[model samples]
Target: KAAYNKYLSDKRAKSTRAYIISQGIDPKRIESAIGYGEERLLNGCDGSIKCTSAQHQLNRRSEFIIVDM
Candidate 1:
């Protein structure tokens, strides 16, 4: 399960990066795209505990950080 989650996360990150580049953003302007996977759960829903579907959905998301240089 963990491996599958990581794989899905990786695909999501790469897809997001590709979409951004497709939008005319220079590839060089983006430093890197990474997926933390289950390692960075937003809430306490780490499989060991029961959580609502909405809570799990919250953890499945993408975040972008813009850096000013």
Candidate 2:
């Protein structure tokens, strides 16, 4: 399950990055897609805790940070 989660996270990040570039955003301006792979949880949903599918879905996400203007 862990491996699959990481795989999904990576795939989603890659797709999102590609999408941003497809929208005409400068490729150089965009940072490489980084997947935390369950390292951070938005709703504290983790393997130890039983959460609804909806709650677990929250952890599958991507964050875009602007390092330079």
Candidate 3:
């Protein structure tokens, strides 16, 4: 299960890269996509929720940022 989740997360990051590149963002100008994988919770919840599916979905979500190179 962990392996599969990581796989999907990686795929999502790659898609984001493709998107930025297609939008005329230089591939080299773009930074790498990072997937923290449920390590940081928005609500400070340690993922104690008995149901893991929803938590997994949330963890797979991506975050982006722009900064001076």
- Tens digits of lDDT, candidate 3, 14-68: 8888988899998878779755444555643344656466655565567777788
User: Each candidate's lDDT (Cα)?
Assistant: 0.87, 0.84, 0.67
**Tens-digit lDDT string for candidate 2 (1-69):** 877777888899999999999999899998689776777779878788889999988888888999987
Ten residues in a row with the worst lDDT in model 2? 31-40
Clashes of each: 0, 0, 0
User: Per lDDT, what order, best first?
Assistant: 1, 2, 3
Q: What shift in Å separates residue 53 of candidate 3 from its native position after superposition? A: 6.4
Query: For candidate 3, what is the lDDT?
Result: 0.67
Question: lDDT, candidate 3, residue 50?
Answer: 60
Candidate 3's TM-score:
0.65
Q: Please identify model 2 stretches exceeding 4 Å from their true place.
A: none
Models ranked on TM-score: 1, 2, 3
Residue 63 displacement in candidate 1 (angstroms): 1.2
In the range 1-69, model 1's lDDT, one tens digit per residue, is 888888888888889999999999999988887777799998988799999999988888878778975
RMSD of each: 1.2, 1.4, 3.2
Cα misplacement distance, residue 68 of candidate 3 (Å): 1.5
